[model samples]
Structures are given as structure tokens and as C-alpha cells.
Target chain A: MATMPASPAAPSSDERLARTGPATRIMRRPEFGAAIGAIVVFVLFALVDSTGKFASLDGIARWTDSAATIGIVAVAVALLMIGGEFDLSAGVMIGTTGLVLGLLVTEVGLGIWPAILLTFVFAAAVGAMNGWLVVKTRLPSFIVTLATFFSLQGINLGVTKLITGTVRVAGIDRGAGFDSARAVFATDLWEPYRFRIAVIWWIAFTVIATWLLTRTQFGNWIFAVGGDANAARNSGVPVHRTKIFLFMGTAMSAALVGIMTALRLRSVQAGQGVGQEFTFIIAAVVGGCLLTGGFGSAIGATVGASIIGMAFIGIAFAGWNTDWSFLFLGLILFMAVMVNTLISRRASAGATK
Target chain B: MTTLSEAPVPTGEKILELKDVSKSFGSVIALRDISLHVEAGSVTCVLGDNGAGKSTLIKTLSGVHEPSTGTYEVLRKPVRLSSPRDALALGIATVYQDLATVPLMSVWRNFFLGSEPTTGFGPLRRLDVKKAKQIARDELLRMGIDIRDVDQPVGTLSGGERQAVAIARAVYFGAKVLILDEPTSALGVKQSGVVLKYIVQAKERGVAVIFITHNPHHAYLVGDRFFLLNRGRMMENWTRDEVDLDSLVKAMAGGAELEALAHELESLGGAAASAAEEVADVVSHPTRGEDTR
Candidate 1:
């Protein structure tokens, strides 16, 4: 072999930064623009909505209370999406889980804790099936989850009818330890603040999801599988396992939300979560998650839920017809998607350069 | 630099030995009776054309697929590699053409994709970011790769740099046998040279390198022993002392067929030259070179 050339001297930090150029400049701070946009929105809303309810602690608590449930589900969906899969069944799985729990404790006379554990298991099994079908058939997750979504929706209605003789399952409040379970799941953390327990769970979920997506070995697999399935598989990342876990996570998160909702209402309805799937996905996308996968944060999704919460409450507080909420949401979704698209393009392009 | 004669006798101690390994996809035999030896600290170049079962052979070695017949040995011990994990545990790392790196992920993240180091208390533990960054930088630097930041996504690096990172990662993970699939095929001239340098570096570190490529030029540059495959069969095996660059290129390019094509082209050129000369007086010379001018 020829004599090895003298190793190129390492560049200094400044020189290295310069080597990054504009593309690296963008990559060095992929989320800076999004952060700025969030800040701008916060400021804009804070300024325009200086009215009594807008600036009051009551309004803050109410907005957060509204944001909490959606945020939890959105964070979980974000993780699943990052793992390069989608879970359309997540929203409906909530109803299934709550019904199961409601039926278990109220009708079957089972203990609350046992019912909760069994519901989680059932949710996880549904998730595992979703993942298995997707991986084994090599089908698109969008289609796979869509099928599961419809199937679960049908089951939610059909099973609720079969068990309760109606589309609603009630009498959950009559069970023993109902008060304790309600305190655990739906208790207001701060007195007079009316903050729901789901808010704490949502925040905890955001923190945990963020940690799982960034710090853990599982996080690495999530990115790998989403980023490139073949490459991840070649690297021995267990692509199938990662996707399955993500699906399970999505379902479990939905189940948790379902449990909270059922506890808060003391009843489970078949149609309760039928239309919330799109809302969760929109929040996730707005929070900077790429629908194509491999890039996102749980915090971003939480922020997205906050944005949605703000628009919903702000419009109503302004005395505008709340019917415009959907229109406003659609517009926000469009803008968020556009912004995320640009960021993703810049991120991928920067990496290539 | 040690000359070939001054270098220690290789002792025929095969680090990885494949004996009559065959594989088939349906009725088509992808590889048949392919036997080869990879010695420690030596580069074993497997040269082949587009469909000569180069991929099949590598997949078998990397545990992506099991060989249908024959025996394979690792460090002189016959063992079956059932999965990619098995191959990795056996200290065999395969760096494919795509390099198995997530484009959007940081260089260090890609470097330690599956095996990440963590530190802290309990389930709330964090990745050892400093250590991971330091190791990625050091390992790549040792391989003569001078990337700006390990924090940058691997996709930002040049193709050659990416290949170097993959090689460095394999070495850091204690890989005794490194399998590289067409590491140079997708690179430019300068980039190819850079990757070749890393291949030599790995070889110098006593790692048995399996350099798979259709490019005989690359094979000649780093290969200590060459195994040539054609039509899913082993055409020839040559030690460094036995083969020259020209012979290797010819064999890869279909020796007699290339010669025949060359002869045909040469004959056609001669005929064209004679015809041009005959028409020279009548034709305009504006397109001709200085001699005509």
C-alpha cells in the first residue's frame, strides 16, 4: 500500500462552525424558528386577549384543563409517528378501554385496580395486533390503523349495546372504591384552581415521552425505525419490536385518557372519542412532528395542544361563535404543517450537505 | 513500510473461512460452492459483476441469510450465524453500501444507534452524552476522518466520510472481521481514496476486512488476497503475489470477452481511419487538429 498521507489537521471550533455554512446554520438550530413562532403566538395572544377572563388564573387553568387530555394522547401519537408508524385506532381505543373498565367494575363487580390493569393489557394487545399486522403484511400503517379504528369504533358501539342495552355504560359511581379511583384519576390537583388530574398525567407523559424519545436506547430505535426501516433492521435495531412498542404506547395512552374521561363523567359513551383522532394528529403535526416520521418532540406536541386550547377558548372568550373553532383549527393546522414541512426540508438538506 | 517479503508469513490462519457455501433464491442459485478465507490483518477482496451473488455471499456472512450448504468458520471454529445479532456478537460487523445510518440523526447517535452508553440513577437515567460524543470524535479521528461536529447528522458528511464513520464504529465495537459492501462504488475518485485509506487503517489494526466491490481498481489497492466470482461460482482465488492490477481488471471485466470487444473496437477504428484518410483531400479540415491546420 502507499504511504498514508499525513492526517488533515482538525479544524478549530470557529472553523468547524464556518464549515457548516448556512445549511449547518439551520441544522444547528432546527427548532429555533418553531420556538420563536411559539413565543410570537404567546405574545400575540397575551396582548390581544387582555380582558378579564383571558388574563385571569381561571382562564389559564381552564385552557390547561382543556389542553391536558389531548396533549397526553398527542404526545403518545407523536412517539408512534416518530417510530415511523401511525395509530388511527388511538382515539377509538380510548372508548373501548373506558367501556371495558366501566363494565368490569360496575357490571362484573371487579375491583378497580384489577380492572385498570386488565384494560391496559387489552389496550396493549390491540396495539400489538396493529403493529403485527402492519409489519407482517408490510402494509402502510395509515391503512392498518384505519382498519383498526373502524373495527374498534364498531366494537365500541356494538359491545356497549350488548352489555348495557344501550350505547352508554353508567353506574361506575356506585362501585366500591369509586371515590378513591376518581380521586386518583380525575381529582383536581389545586383547590379552587379546578385543574384536572389528567393535566398532571399529561405533563408527566410529556416529560416521560420526551425522555424516552431523547435519552433512552428505545428512543434511538424509534428514530432509527422511523428514519430508515431497512437501515435500522440492518443495524440490528429490531424494527418490528420498536414499531410494536410504539403502537402499544399509543393505545395505552388512549386507554389512559379514556379512563380519565370516564371517571370525570362517571359514564362511558360509545361516541365519546369518535372524532378526536384528527385533533390528536393535528396537534402532533402542529407541534413539529413530521407525518413522514423520524423527527419530533413530545413537548412540541404539548405546545400544539396548548395552541389548540388557546384558539378554542380565545374565540369563545372574544364572544365569537365557537362554531368557527373548526375553521380556525383547520387554518392553524395548515400553517403548522407548512412550517413543519419547511423545517423538515431544511433539516434533511442540512444533514445531506 | 514493510515490503511483501518482509511482512510476516500469513500462516493460512483464516479468521473467517467459508467452504463450498451455496445459496439459491427459488430455482436460481445465487451462489454455488463459494469458498474463501479471510485472514487476520489482511484484506480479502471479493470481486464480482452485477449478479454474481456478491450480495448473497455477504448476506450469508453477515447472518442476514443462512447458507444452504457447506460449512463456515469464524476464528477457526465452525459455527452457524443465525441472525445479524449473532454475527455482531461474533465481532463481525457489516457496513453495507447504504451504511445503516439515519440521515436525520446526529453522527454520534448513528455511531451508537443500538448500543448507547447511559449513566445516572435508575429509570430516569440519561445518555452519557459527553462520553458518546468524545468516543465518536476520537474513533473517527483515529480513522483519519476529520468531521467538524459529531453532533451534526451523518447525512451532512460526504459519502466517503460516512463510510469512514461506519468503519470506525465497527472497529470501536470490537469488530474482528469487517464486511464492507461496495464502499467505493458510490463515491467520487477522491472520496474512494479516503475510504481505501480507512480500509488500510483497519487492516493495519489487525482486523480482517472483506472488501466487496465490482471495482477491481479498489480491490487492487487494498486487497491482500482476492477471490473472484462469476455466474455465482468462484472463478479464481489469487494471493497478492500472484495477481497484478491488469489481470484483476481483465478478469472482472470478463477477460476473453473484453479482449474480443477491444479487438473489435480496434478493427473498427482502423477501418474508420483508412476511410477518413481517403476522403481527406475532398473534406474540409476545420474540425481537424493542428497537424491538419
Candidate 2:
């Protein structure tokens, strides 16, 4: 019997083999494709717009306002996706929150501030319910949140008609706290430019969400829970807590959008935000957040919403019917996803040693 | 002090010990009558084939399963561990075959998944990204794992490199007994050698390393003590001086079974010579060249 020799590779291989250069490191970022797509879409819209208004401040604000509403929800959904869950109820939750606030202020004879606060509480409960059901049942969050989406859609329509005898509720501005609530949620800024306050909230949300996702311990947990929940649980990460918070956070973001819409219109329609959940998901995927989870960033979703906003308003500026925007969005999603898949394939193969 | 083989034998205090340990699920005994001692500053290789109770032995030791009989001791003190967390608290970190890493996360994040370094105060406290990245780089460098960039996603790493990173993490976290579950089972020759090198480094750092692998070549190269398991039973145990590579392989391949086959093949003589070599290669490299069979 031969005694085995020690490995010659036993000599220290720890010489910092070859540090990845800045360029390669940049390419590996989950949002790299989204950043490029945002720029390309911006340039294409600028070139196509016949009125040259797409380049102007007000036009930028017009799309940014649209983008901000979608951006706020997209950011939360991005984090949810990163944490390996989804909130299909996000769209209708917006309508539900708004209708809740509208009915409380008008029918229940409550002040606007109290009504808004109660609406947030209700939204948080719904979000918690969605998360608890997903974790407890071990069901795919897709199925769980899908059920939530249908239930909330029914509540938004049924509850509104049941109380008001109409599909819409109006006159929320007549409440005592209406002036302050409008200032907080619906106030216009840079009046000449027609900028909505939602843009500021959107930017703030993106920055805070970006910081939380990339710069905090909770952020690391988000990646872990999504990457492999079993591994994350074995590693002693609070996987359930991380997931629950994300679900609740996403629901609250939708509620904020709902508040903004209700305050702006002083009315709430039963079907106001129906079918918009797909829009938020579209922005997230376009921003490079993988639907499978564990590989996306909040900033990527923000960029994705920006792209959507540009397409929505840019199509109109270019003298085309605004209905073409959905077709335009489908094209961008396919193109961005294709680009992302190609890049990630190369990035995953980038291990040099 | 240095007579020849520098590899230390199982001496000094035992970091972990199993005495007449047996585990079972109903009537199915996964492990029975297995006794082993892992001493500090040594590599103890657990050798076995597919159903040789290796995983059962691992689970029993790592607090994944409670032994049905006998005592398991940590640092000479007999105790019971309810979960992996309890074992980890006692510095018995197990780097399983999968490495338990988040592939999309950066190396630093993966390095400190459960235990993150924090700075600042209260709500302002964050991950301390700069410190985490630096420590991840430094700790891996200590293990002689030449990582390219700490910021790169861990999925981009080779299998061996990822294992090295996991091992380094265990060491940095002050693990006294590092349990590596089939660290080289999924690696090629060159990559396996890379991991084997780190096993030596880990031992030199005074860790009682439990190196689990079926490959006799890897086990023989670094293993100072060997415990052979077959069908949920301890077939034999030997120190470095008592066993060599061929015997280890024969035992791992089931000594009686291989001998019977050897005798049967001898009857076939010259025509079976190539077939015997093929079997030898398959036995030697259990992890590779499997498709040919």
C-alpha cells in the first residue's frame, strides 16, 4: 500500500489571484441592464417626440408623476421579489385604501386625517394577512397574493357600491382635515411646472428603499431569504420576519398611492386601480428584478418605472395615440428581459480562476 | 519533532468525541456502534461509500439528529444539542456540501449571512459594508484562498473556491471543530486538490477538522485518522501508522466484496485485465469518470 503524497497545490494560493476590474464588477450589477435601457428609452423618446416637449421640464414632470406612482409600488415589489415573494394585491389595494378613506370621510362622517390613518392600518393588516398566509401554508406567494388580489378587487367594488349606492365616492374635500391631507398627499409643487408631490415621495421612497436594500443588515437578509429560504433558515437568519416586513411594506406603499389619488381627485372609484398590478410587476421585471426572486434591486425597479413613464408620455408627445403605450411597454419588457438574460449568462460565466 | 510525515496524529484534547453512538429511524438503523475521536490540530477523515451511514454519522455529530444510544461529547464534556444553532454556539460549524451560500449575493454578504458586523447606533446602525468586505477578503486570504474580488457574486466562483470561502468563514468565526461534509465530492482533480490544501491549512490553525469524502486519494493525502463505515456499522478504525492508501480504498470499497470480485476476475485472466483496470479507476475516482460506467 502506497502512502499518499501531500498536494503540491498546498502552497498558499491566497495571493489575491486577479481582482475583478471596475468594468467587470459594474457589469455584474443586477441593475446594469435597467440603467442602459432607461437611457436608450429616454433618447428614443426625445428623438421621436414631434412637439420637442418631451425634453421640457413640465413634460419630464408629467411622465415622472406617472412614474412616481408606479415607482413607489415597484420599489416595494422589487424588495418583495428579492425576498422571494410577490404581492398581486398591490394594485387593487390602492383602490381599496382610497375607497376606505373616501367612505370613512364622507359616509362615516370622519375627518380626513383619521380616515387616512385608519386606511393605512387596514392596508397593513391586509399585507400582514397576505404574508402570514404565504409563510404558514408554504404556498407559492404567487397563489396566495393572487387570491388576495381577487378578494380585494371584490371588496373595492362591492364595498363601494354597498355603502354609496354608486360605483364611485366623491366630496372627500369637504372634510375638516381635507386641507392638510391634500397638502401632504396631493399638493402640487413648482406650480408653473405642474409637478405632483408624489414625485418627491417617490424619490424619497426609492432612496430609502435603495439604502435599506443595499446598505443594511436587513438588506442582506432579504437577499438570503430569496436566494434560498432553507439555507437562510439554517444560517440563523430571521427569514420569516424579513418576508413579513416586505409584504407589509409593499401594502403600505400601495396605500400611500391610494391616499395620493383620493386626495388629488377628492373621489374614489370602485374600479380605480383594477388591472394596474400588472403595471407595477412589469416595471419591476423591466428594471431587471427577476420574477424568480433573489436577484433584483429597488433602484432597478425605480429605473424600470422611469422607462414606463417615458414610454407612456413620450408616445403622446410624438403625436401617436396613447393606447400604443401598452404595445410599446410589451416591446421594452421583451427587449430588456432578453438583454438581462444574455448579460447574466456572461456574468455567471465570468469566474476566471 | 519532524521524523517524516508532518501531519499530526490524533493527540492532545479531543474537540469532539462519539462513544458507541447509534442512530435509527424506526427499525432502519442509519448508524450503529460508531466510535471516533477528533483531536485538535488534526484532520480526521470519515471514509464511506454511498449508503455507508456517512450522512447519518454527520447528522448525529452536527446536532441534526440525536443519537438513539451512547454519548456524544464536546470538548471532553458529554452534552446534548437540540439544533445546529446549539452546535454552532459551541463552535462546531459545519460547512455542508452545498456551502449554504446565497449565489446572487456578493462574497462579503455571503460571508456574514447570519452574523453581520454593524456600526453606528440605534436605527442609524447598518451592515458596515466597508468593514465586512475587508474582513471577508482578509479572512479568505488567511486560508490561502486566492479570491479574485470580494464584491463579485458568489455564483461566479468555482465549486472549490466557494468551499474554501465557506471553510474560511467557519475558521474566522472561531469554530473549534470544523465539520466539512464531502468538501471535495463535487470537484475535479485540480479543484479537489485546492480544497485538500485548505484542509491542511485548517489543521495547522489548530482546528479539529472533520473532513468527509468518499475519495480515498483525498482522504489518504491529508487524513491522520480514518474511520470506515459500511451499512450503518463501523467496519474499522485506524491511525495513520496502521493504514495506507490501498487498504483504505479496499475497505471503503467493501474489503470482502472486492476480494471476491478479484478472485472471480482472476479466473477470466488476460481477457479481463482491461476490465479490472477500469474497475480500479472507478473505485479510485468515485467522483469522476462516472458516465463511462
Candidate 3:
């Protein structure tokens, strides 16, 4: 018998190995692709702006208002993505929540504060139900949430017409506490440009979400559960609870956006926010959230939302045919995902070497 | 080089003992009358071929499955484990091949995955990123694993490095009985050597290492005792002194069974017969075959 010699690749001075440079480190970030995409799109829109105001403070306000609403939900959707799930009902959830608030104020004769609070509760309950069905049935969240999306679409239209005798609910401005609710959710800031309060909310929410994803224990569990559910379970991570909470978060964010829209307009149509689910998911994917889950950043989702918002406002300002907007979006999504995959592959390989 | 003519004796305390353990999955008996005890600071190799109940034995030991009939004692105290977490609490960690680490996550995150150490108080408490990174780096280095960066995803690491990370994690988390399910089965020769070195290092750290592998050469390299399993039964158990490399290989290769298979192949004649004869030749003269040992 021969005694085995120790492994030759035993710990040597790793200092002799190449250290990762700042550029490589930055490139390896999950949000790197989104950040680059955002810059390029911003430049493209600024160059093509026919009104020239597309690069001004007024233009910033207009695009930010658009981005803020999408950003809020996209961030939460990004979190859900990182936790390995999807919420297709998120867009329709806004309509469900808006209609719920509309009825509570205009029909139920409740104050704006009470109606807004009740709408949040309704949305949270629905979100929890979406989560419960996903976890219990072990069905793809796509199928389960799609079921929810269709069900809520029917409810939003059917219930609104049933109660108001019209597909749209109005006259919410007359409800008690309407002024304070509007100031908080839909009020504008700045003297001339008038930035929407939702912009502030978006920034604040992004900060909170970023912190939750990077600094906390729940954040780690999110990555683990998304990356490998079995490994997470084996490591004693609470996979079910994390996923359910992620669903609740996306729903609640939708409610916040819904309430903001309702208060700002003082009315809501039953079909409001119908197809916005794709926009939210598109923003997340563009922002560097993997469609398969287990990787993303809140800031990346925010940047992704900004890209969509810019595209919407910028295309109209550029006097181009707005009909081609979706085509542009498809191209951006493809390019962003391609860039992200390529960079991540290169970065991982480089770091290992 | 250390002396190889004589077998090494394990003189440490018995840390884990399984007495007449048997596990059944409804109608199918996975493990039967499996009795083995592991000593602290020693490597116990469980050698078997495919479908030889090695995975069942690892699962039973790691608390993933409970024995239908047997007593499992840890440090002389009989305990029934409800889950892997329970086993973890008792310092028994099982590292499963391909299921050990989250591939996309950073090395530091995978290191402190389930039981992350947090700083601050109340809701303000967060993962101690700085401290976690430092400790993960130190722990891997301690185990002779020089990772390029703690922030790199585990998927970038070679197969052997991933196993080393899992082993380091188990060791850091106070795993008394380390159950590695075929840690080297998926690795190349050099990579297998890397893992085998860690097994010895883990044993040197006074860990009761349970190294599972199909390769007898790997077992002979570090194992202080050997348990051969066949069809869920403990076919043989031997101390290092009672076994030699040649007999160990012949026994694992199924001494008489290989001869029977070679003869059966020879009946095909021509090229098949010549190939079978060569195989028979190697089987008859084991030293003339691959110097895997």
C-alpha cells in the first residue's frame, strides 16, 4: 500500500493570483447591464427629442411621473423575482384596488383615509391568496396569477357597473379627508415643474428594497430560495414564508399605485391598469432580473422602469409614430438581457481564473 | 512520505454509533441491520457500487430519513432526529453531491446561509457582511482552500472547490460527524486528490469524517476503517490492518463476479473475446492494471 501525498494545489499565496480590478468588479454586478441600458436609452431619447424639452426639467418631471408608478411596482416585482416567483395579477391588482377605493369613497360614503386603508387591506388579502394558492397547489405562479388576473379583470368591470351603473367611478374628491390623502399619495412637489409625490415614494421604496435585499437575513433567504429551493430548505431557510411575503409585497405596491392614481384623478375607470403587468415584468427583466429568477436588484428594476417611462414620453416628444413603441421595447429587452448574460458569464469566468 | 507498509490504527473516542439500524420505504427495504460506529479524529469510508444503499445510509445518518428499526446514538446518548436541522443542532452535517450549495449566490452568502450572524438590534439587525466575508475567507483558508474572491458565485468554482466550501461550512458550524455523500465521485483525478486532502485535514481537525465513495483507491488513501455494503446489507467491515489495497480492489470489483462476466463476454468471439481476455488478464494480475491506488 502507498500513503497518499497531500494535494499539490494546497493553499498557496493567493496574492500571486490576479486581483479583480474595479472595472471587473463593477461589471460583475447584477445591475450593470441595466445601468448601461438606461444610459444609452437616455442618450438616444435626448438626441431624438423634437420638442427639445425632453432633456429639460419639465421633461424630467413628465418622464419621472411615468417611471415612478412603474418603478414602485417593478421594484417589488423584482424582489418577488429574486425570491423565485411571479405575480401576473399585479397590473390588474391596481385596477382591483383602485375600484375598491372608488366604491368605498363614492358608494360606501367612507372618508378617503378609510377607503385608502381598506383598499390596501383588500389588496394584501388578494396578494396573500395568490401566494397561498401558489404554495398550496404547487402550481406555476404564472398559471395561478394568470387565473387571478382574469378573475380580477372580470370583477373590476362587473362590480363597477353593478354598483355605479357605469364602468367608471367618479366624484371621489367629495369624500372626507380627500385633501390630506391626495397630498400624501398624489400631491406634486417643486414650484414650476411640479414633481409627483409618487416619485418621492419611488425613491424611498427603492432605497428600502435595496437595503432589504442586501443587508438583512430575509434578503439572503430570498436569494437562496430563488437560486436553489432544495438547497435553501436543506440549509433551514424559510422558503415558503419568503415567497408568500414577496407576493404580498407586489400586491401592496400595486395598491399604493392604484390609490395614487385614483386620488390624483379623483376617479378611476374599471379597465384602468389592464395591460400594465407586462410593463412591470418588462421593467424587471430589463433592469437585470432573470426571467428564471434567483438574481436581480431593486435599483435595477427602478432603472428598467425609468427606461420604459422615457421611451413612452420620449417617443411622443420625438414626433415618431407611437405605434412603434412596443417594437422598440422588445429590442431593448433583447439587447439588455443579452448584454447581462454575456457580461455575467465573462465576469464569473474571469474571477475564477 | 509517511510509512505505508503498516496500517494506521484509530485510537480516538467513539463519537457516533448505529446499532442494527434498518430503514424501509413502505414496501422496499433500503437499509437492513446496518451497524457502524465512527470514532472522533478518524475517517470511516463507506464503499459500495451503484444501488448499494450508500445514499440510503447517508440519509439515515444525516437525519433525512429515520430508521424503521434501530438505535442511533450520538456520544452515547440515543436520539431521534426529526429533520436535518435537528441533526445540525446535534453537530451532524451531510453534504450531498450537487445539493450542497446555491450556485448563483456569493461564496460568503453560501457560507453563512441558513444560520447567518446578524448585527444590531430589533428590525435594524442585518447580516454582518464585513464580518461574514472575513470569517468565510478565514474558514476556507483554514481548510487549505484559497478562494479567489468571497463575492464570486459558487458556480464559478470547480467541483472540488464547491465540496471544500461545503465541508468548510459544515466544519465551521460545528459538525461532529461529517457525512459526505460521494464527495469525490464527480471529480477528476487531480480534483479527487484535492477533496481527499480535505478529508484528511477535516479528520486532523478531530472531526469524525464519514467519507462515501465508490472508488476503493480513494478510500484507501484516507480511511481508517472500511464498511462494504451490498444490497442494503453490511457485507463486510474491516479495520485498516485487516485490508490490503489489492484485496480491497478485488473485493470491490467483485472478484468471482468479474471472472464470470469476462467468460460470458469471451463467448462472443473475435474482438469481443480478445477484449474479454485482456480484462481477465488484468483481473487475474491486479498489479498490472491501472495504478489508481
Candidate 4:
């Protein structure tokens, strides 16, 4: 019942009592609590893993190496989610992009940069298809992307066997421009520690995604479309175009991860990146994104990826079974959701009064 | 005494003028020849029933749909508002009953949603949070809405408060012609009064307001000019001086038809009074026995 009192016609004592201070007036963002939680988790992990390997530069590099790939994908997925859509084909897209590049280089005798460009174009085309199907058909993105996922999965295995006569494509390092491309994608930044180039790409992606989601006009459209598509459309926002852009962005991110992985391994495996869509979504939701959309941050998605990376490494370092990682991820996702729900409830309740 | 010549000029003075606007979805005509004018610095109330063309009229004015055949004028210029952005550019902002705002977003964020200001050095430019919060607070205060915090999600506010916030936003964003669709139709008596006060505030600020509602009392309270619509057609267009409250109410309630129906029902009830009294006595005695038992 501590409500904002009605304005008085004359100056009154009640008016003075009801006035709130400026410091107390700052609107509470949903990400604030999540940021605090991330910091606390980081400190806790740092404290408990006091062993030299856990605290060392090598350990930091190892954890971040794992965190980067997931972070990149998660950020893109978060944008798509905020734009009120989903891309189930994101995970499978990695295999498709890598396979496409592999075929282009070895079978088609194309150079590395052309292969990369072609792969990106293919990724964009696939993304466009997803967007076109979703918009034109007026079908749920989940169903549309699921269809794309299965179709791409089939193509990945079928095409690799047809081109390479094997389930994997190797000798990418022997291709033209291989040395320079590998230097850019797979090079160890620190010689002794072997910190990956992918980690840099991940951080860069996070920065760009955060800027695009929070600063640009497109970001506003994304939030509006996710929050209420009908309303956004009525308000003159191009909801369909924004969603299409989001879908394409996600596919491109997955393709980038695929290229990095193929370069790092110097091989393209048809089975790579299958069944990992849920992980990207889980990471985003744990980082303080609502599955319902309209509220999430790129930084939060990165933090969520970091948490996943930490847990994966930390548990292994503790000598626990790596298979238990899924269980731990599920538990963390539940806890994060519970905490987020409570914070949102309190924030809304505070606003009402 | 006022002469018809001295009456308000029916010239190019309308901020928003809809002429013979009609819309049809296949064979069903949703709206038919709905001609209305909303002048600057005044409230033109559009009254109607559930199936009436109120929504159609709103959609047309707000640029959701192009009228099948009618001219729409803004600032006396006949222009086709193909999109809501066009309407907004012309300083015509519509605050629908549902109010286009993300309930989970902070009041300040919702206030400056599509048009957030930014400040800072290159690559470090961020939302002007301080300015946004201050402006949101000031605008709401101008509308007589004193909130405890500008940071709170707008969803937390009451229905009336949300409507007021939307009005405040429209006014702050240079909305010269504000179209509010059924703003107070969902509120309680006290809440409706609060909304009406803000509507009056918008008028006092020299903004032309198109207040659409079914409530005659609420409309009469702040509306300078009333345009009543029934079945997608204008029933009566009257100024404050021309029509009294009773007449306005009567017009909205279908005037002669409503009065005739009331009279007929009254006579029918009086004729059945003796027979109804015997039946009521028998029902009352049985009810009394049941209650006693």
C-alpha cells in the first residue's frame, strides 16, 4: 500500500512525505542482478580452485578457450531471441558451413579466402531461407528452424561422403593460404601458454553484439518486436525485417564458429556441432534472458557461456565425470531462472507502487 | 445570442479530418462513411457500441489501415498516412487502450523506447540514462502523475497510470494531435476521473485530442466538441454550447428509440403488476419457509 499519492491542488505535508530521492529513482534493470551474480560466481570459482593449474595463466586460457566458442554462438542466439524468434538450425549450421568450406577447398580446388567467403555466403543463404520460410509461411520459428536443422544434418553427412569418400575432410592445412588463415584463426597468441585465437574472436563478437543490441536503432526494433510484435508493427517497426536480420546473424555466427573449428582441427567432421542448439539457448537464459523474449543482454549471454565453460572445466579439474556436466548445467539453468523470476517480480512490484 | 455565422468555421481548421471513410473486409463492411473532424486544442469524443466502427475509425486514423475511400487531413493538408511513422511525423500520435509499452521495461526506457538519446565518446557512447530518467519524471509530473520511481517497470503501474504515462509520452514527443482510443473504458470511477484530468491537461497544453470512449459522462467532462458515432456513421456533432449533458447522453443512448423502449417496458411492467404480485407473494412465502427451516 505504499503507493504514489495523488497530486494535491495545494501544497501539503503529505506531498512532502511522499517525495522520493533521486538516488532511489533509478530504474532497476533486469541485468543488474545477473551481473552481480556473475561476479560472485567468478570470485567463488577463483577462491575454491586455488590450485596452481586453476589459478594459473594456462588455466585461465584453457577456460576462456572453451568459453569463447559458446559465447559467440550464445550472443547471436540472444539477439535472435530478443527479436522474437529462434534458430534451431544454429547448431547444425556449424557442420554445414565447415563442410561447405571443406568441399570448396579440396574438391572444387578453391583457395582458403574464397572458401571462407563462399562458406559465409552459404551461411547467409541458409539464414535467408530460414527467415523467408518463417515470414512467408507465418510458421513458428521453432518448427521452421527444426526443419532446417534436420535438412542440414542430412546434407552434411550425405555431401561429405559424396565429396571426400569419408565422413571427415582432412588436409585443410595443405590448402593454399592455409598457413596465413591458420595463423589468423588457430594461432596460439602466447607461445608457451597456447591461448587460442578463437578467444579473441569471442570477445570481439561479444562487444559487437552488445553494441548492436543496446545502442543501435536495430536494437530498439529487436526489443520492440520481441516485446510485442503486433504493437511494434502498429508503431511502424518492420518486425519481419528485424527478425530476418536476427535469423541471418545467428546463422553467420554459427558458420564463423564452424570455420574456426575446421581450421583449428585442420579437418571437417560431418557430425560436428549437432545437437548443441539447446546449449546456446540454455546459456542465454542462464545469463538473464527471458525465453519469452524482449529482455536479455549480449554481455549476459557471454557471462552465461563463461559459467558453462567454468563449470565444464572446474568439474573435470575436481576429478568428477565429465558426463555430469549436463546435470550441472541443468541445475544452474534452473537456479538462474528462479532467481531471475524473483528479481523480475520484485522489480515490477516496486514499479507499481 | 449566437448566430450560425459566428459558429466555428468548418474550413481547414481541423487537425484531423476524416471524410466518408469506409472499410470492408470482403463482403462485411466494418466501417461505412464515418466522417469526423478533430480540431486543434479540443477533444472530439467518438462514442459507439461494441460492433460499431470505433476500432475501424481508430485503425484508420492511426494509420493501421488505409480507408477504402475517404480523405484524411492533418493540419488541413490532405495526406495519406501509409504507416504509423507517417502519422507520428505529422504530430499525430495514437495511444491505444492496450498502450504499446513493454511492461517489463523501466518507465524511462518505455518513455523513450524507439528514440533513446545517447552521449559519450566514440565506441563508449551509451544511453543517456540520467537525461531519460529526468525527462520521464518531468513529463509524468506535467500530466499530474507523480510516480515513486522512474526506474520501475511500467507494468507495475495501474491501468489508469499507464494510460496517463502514454498520454504524457505523446505530449512530450511533440504530439500536436493526440488520438486516444478508449483510454478510460477499462478503469474504475476514480481511475477514470484521473484519466479525464490528464485529458484536460493535454487540452490545456494546447494539443488537439481525439478522445474515443463509450462513456458519455467521462466525455462530457473534458470534451470541447463531441462527435457521437453509431453503426459507423456520425449520429451527432455538437459543441459544448450547443448540447447539454442530458441531450448528449440521450443522443448516445439512441434518443427517441431508447426513450420509446423505456416507456414501453414501463407500461408492460405496470400492466403485469397484479399478476406479478401474486406470483411474487407465492415465491416469497416459499423462500421465507425455506429460510426459517
The lDDT leader among the candidates is: 3
What C-alpha lDDT values do all the predictions have? 0.81, 0.84, 0.88, 0.78
- Give per-residue CA lDDT, model 2, range A12-103, as digits (tens): 34323555567766776878998999999999999998998898997998899899999999999999998988889999999999999998
Candidates in descending lDDT order? 3, 2, 1, 4
> For residues A1-353, what per-residue lDDT tens digits would candidate 3 score against the true structure?
32545535743333226666899889888889999888898899999999999989999999999999999999999999988899999999988898899899988899999888899889889989998999899999999999999999999999999999999999989999999999999999997999999999999999999999999999999999999998888888988888889999999999999999999998999998889998999899988888787899999999999999999999999999999998988998889899999998887664443
Best model number under TM-score: 3
The parts of candidate 4 lying over 4 Å away from their true place are A1-52, A350-353, B1-12, B75-77, B116-138, B141-149, B266-293
Instruction: Give the Å error, residue B47, model 4.
Output: 1.3
For candidate 3 chain A, the 10 contiguous residues with the lowest summed lDDT are A7-16
lDDT of each residue in B1-293, candidate 4, tens digit only: 11112233332256678888888888888888877887766777887767778888888988878989888876566788787877787777999888567666668877887677788857676677788889999999888888767866677677778788888988888888788999988886667777888888888777788998887777777878888788777778888789776666656555556445545555568656555554444333332322211
DockQ of every candidate: 0.42, 0.37, 0.44, 0.24
- Model 1 lDDT per residue over B1-293, tens place: 11112233353457788999999889989999989989978899999998988999999999989899998887567888888888888888999989468887889999988888888877867788789989998888888777667877777777878888889988888888899999988887667778889999999888889999998877888899999999899999999999987678667756566445545555667775555443442222222322210
Residue-wise lDDT of candidate 4 within A89-127, one digit each (tens)? 999998889888887888888999889999999899899
**Model 3 stretches with alpha carbons more than 4 Å out:** A1-7, A10-18, A350-353, B1-11, B259-280, B290-293
Between prediction 3 and prediction 4, the one with superior lDDT is 3
C-alpha TM-score for every candidate: 0.89, 0.90, 0.93, 0.85
For model 3, what is the C-alpha lDDT against the true structure? 0.88
Cα lDDT tens digits, model 3, B1-293, are: 11111223244878788999999998999999999999988999999888889998998888888889999887777888878878887788989888999988999999999999999989899999999999999999999888868987887778888899999999988777899999988887777877888899889988889998888889998999999988899988999999987777877777678888899999989998999898898887776778433
TM-score of chain A of each: 0.91, 0.95, 0.96, 0.90
